[model samples]
Target: MTPTAASERTHLVFDRALVRRRLARAAWLGAEPFLLERAAEDMADRLAAVKRRFETAVDLGTPTDAVARALAGHAAVGHLMRAAPLAAGAPDVVADEEALPFAPGTLDLVVSALSLQMANDLPGVLAQVRRTLRPDGLFLAALLGGSSLTELRQAFAIAESETTGGISPRVAPFADVRDLGALLQRAGFALPVTDVDRVVVRYSSPFTLFSDLRRMGAANALAERRRVPLRRATLLRAAEVYAERFADPDGKVRATFEIVFLSGWAPHESQQKPLRPGSARMRLAEALGAKEVPLPPSGDERD
Candidate 1:
């Protein structure tokens, strides 16, 4: 395989494992019941109105439990769950977003929640998603954005810089809404839309926030990096700094999760076309009717 293709495959493998670990952690975090219940409720409400519009629907990166609940609630639409390690589920098959195993134009709807941001080649994955959807098919996704872990990131940065004299790139970078919208357009998604919602949770201390992240299985797993054991002294210093800088007036530490929601449709042939050539062109300079005067020629140009 070509280098690019090999890289893509590697990314898919890594992302799949990462997400599976996270899901498993979430399952053990005592929050799976609540999270899956909320997910099922939300999916049922959203798909109720549009369930009849699509013939085949797929949930990318869906957990087994969540998918089961969603399928039970929305039995009208054909549902297929996709995720790494294939979790124990009733999904059509295990597949990766960077390269879906479906035939082109086979799907009518694709839904993903808080999953796409973890992709190494997000644009390529989106392109694949676009290809899988039938013409005029709907695409809906939610992803954690740059603002998702501000407090945790701040604490880490402070600790590393103070203790080690430098910082480590442990956390993955996230795309903003504007950049994500531009990527959607580049991937040929029509009528693309993007919006962000902020969810804040308060913690008693920075250590509690770290514990939650670990339990959520959202720990950093950079491809090219070493995992050094964190020192207790450094961790304590980090907690102190985090509390001092990020604590609210009520003395609670807040962690923010900025989620970006996206929706788009595959272009259809029946959509309106552009105007014919030379038909009512509107140039800004011409509309302003500005005059252009020639300047004196340079010495090299003058004969």
Candidate 2:
């Protein structure tokens, strides 16, 4: 039977097959995955301040298992498990970020490092996470933010537009800080908080950034991306544009990797509650030592 043409043309955003393939290749290169390690350290620090013990914890998407390692000897953590992409260093479990196989209310803590930005159905995945957590369970994660790879994205966009007469999704887009906070609430997480950690790394050249991204499994995997490989001229022009516009005084280019950290909790009755409207006994004037001015007369009130 002849193979269908449509199957060959169709591609999915953050294509799982392609991601696994690229990651497998990257594993052979022996490059350190620094981003994952750094984000894992941030999670460990944040967890230390929470002052709560989690008997059962899972570290998701941290391919290097850095979070798991950080949590292992900590007093607050009784056990630690790991889930990573199939091609990555052998995790305790292999799973997709979008689809987890945990039972509802089974977990006490869930943390992810330097992942989730690539999820096609992030809101849905978050909703699933909310359902998976036990009461008062914590969910902490750091994801690449909208500001990440701005230089690379811009250079690729301009180069593609100029050379190919159109621009495709050359670099993946990340979620905004506000949007992620709202998404947590929408996913039924209580007391959601979001903060940004902007990391500006100096690279000798754009190709160095590209090489790092390859090892980090942070490549463009957009569904609408052009099938044809980036033209040599386009790649060279992109490098030129990046160096010209984003280079520092020392000729090293600045590459920003903004990691947005999100923290939320499964709701419990003991958590803080907001006061209802008109519930305060003291007037605004009494509290602030200011007088309330009378409202201006409406047209109907005039004689």
Candidate 3:
């Protein structure tokens, strides 16, 4: 499985320092963390579906600490440790998104909500998660993904190109569902699975959506981002374009937020494995009640 163009830029484009600073500011604002709350709710549903219990668990960089609250009453979780990036709020642990500090096979479970999308080395991050998990340990996570913020990206690109004669990278790219699943399996995790949940939130205007993104610490923090602030003309023009194109009957603009959830487990002897391809007792043609036709012709002979 190949990573999308967006995924390819993680190491080259995202400014890690800028992302941390934005998240720190977002935490200080202490506004309504609707996105985190929603992600937390979905993670809880996933956690509930698992039949086994975890003796030790961690919440990795959940901005509003919503996941901790979600797991508070969960019987499967015996202990909960909350952590954030080095620049973010206080937590039981201070971990870098790129390199987690856990010893091998120490964690029984790890769950993250609305984080991991910004990781510079996503493959390395997945590897670290797999290494930390004990055999049969589970990792459940959610992050922004496919078609997220299409309207905003388009508006910004159009405005900048029109007003400034060039466009700057305004939005960080997110991983698609298939890429995430591939990364999980590549990280040595077993039973990897991924899916998405689309959340379309309406706002009075695109500016209001921008405000909420500010509160969520979701800012354009690309390393290659334009150093100069967006010109007032560009900002206003972008708003105009956004309203014209995305506004609904009520004059509210639409913002698409796609959350991708990934589930994987550390490899273990007890987990089910696929049988060998040729080991099937039934023949493919016989199983399908079809006659097999035999034909042999080399390319040279045919030509």
Candidate 4:
């Protein structure tokens, strides 16, 4: 889609009330506590691995105390800051990734944990991130990706098709690894890497999974949408469809969480440059001793 079209669609898809309700439910579901602890652990591990390389770091979309915990052991304490607001105890400074307040090339490192999936314009946000990094600066992020919540998507699709005769866009679409890598390249990030980690959790019923998602502040956030209450019959039918299609033989439904980890670097003049043309370039066809395939000339290039 064109940028304008995408922006309009994103505005229509994001529902603030749905997000608030999901956050409230997620807090009640103890997702905040669990996520905070996880973030702390991950940050500590990440810091230990890259402390010698980086002198400054920013945690984008860090919504809990994890960023603080991650920076606690780093010598760059003064440079550590968060970019999202949280509860009173959480470490945050209320920032958005799309329009970071930091000056260009000011950051040495940027980390995001389980964030960025909510961004309306992920590529634009990545560009902003790229602009904030110094040459050779590192960018690391984790976000929910495709293959996540397959059971939920299937269940919702079945329910809507059978009940409403149409499917509503409930869950936000996530980027696959390939698409995410391309986006990083498009944003001018160097040596971009993308990896997926699949986490499967079992639930006794579909309701249990739904409840967990709500507690995690993950729900439908589409704006300009109807808010009709789900009927009992529809709910039961959804549950049945979920169990029959997504359940294991043990009767528990499996929910897949595909976490995508990405890392890249800011371009630098000192970095290795591409080889000059006509210099020894490795051609796959030549290496394989295969005949070169002729391409159809464009209208402009035709003889």
The numbered model that scores best in TM-score is 2
In order, what lDDT does every prediction score?
0.70, 0.83, 0.85, 0.74
| Predicted structure with the largest lDDT when compared to the true one | 3
Shift in Å, residue 191, candidate 4:
1.0
Model 4, which residues run further than 4 Å from truth? 1-12, 16-21, 32-51, 74-78, 86-89, 281-303
When sorted by lDDT, best at the front, the candidate numbers are 3, 2, 4, 1
Candidate 4 global CA lDDT score: 0.74
Each prediction's TM-score against the native?
Answer: 0.78, 0.91, 0.91, 0.80
Q: Score residue 275 of candidate 3 by CA lDDT.
A: 94
> Among all windows of ten consecutive residues in candidate 1, which has the lowest summed lDDT?
30-39
lDDT (C-alpha) at residue 31 in model 4: 66
lDDT score at residue 37, model 2, on the 0-100 scale: 79
lDDT by residue (tens digit), candidate 1, 136-204 = 888877777888787777887888789888787656677888999999999899988788778788888
Per-residue lDDT of 75-152 in model 3, one digit per residue for the tens?
788899987785556678987666688888999999998778888888877888888899999999998996899999
lDDT of 1: 0.70
Q: Which is the winner by lDDT between candidate 1 and candidate 3?
A: 3
TM-score-wise, the better of 1 and 4 is 4
Q: C-alpha displacement of 178 in model 4, angstroms?
A: 1.2
What tens digits encode model 4's per-residue C-alpha lDDT throughout 62-171?
54555566667676334677776442224446655455777899999888877678777788778888988999898888788988887888888898889888877766
Worst 10 residues of 3 by lDDT: 1-10
User: Clashes in model 3: which pairs?
Assistant: none
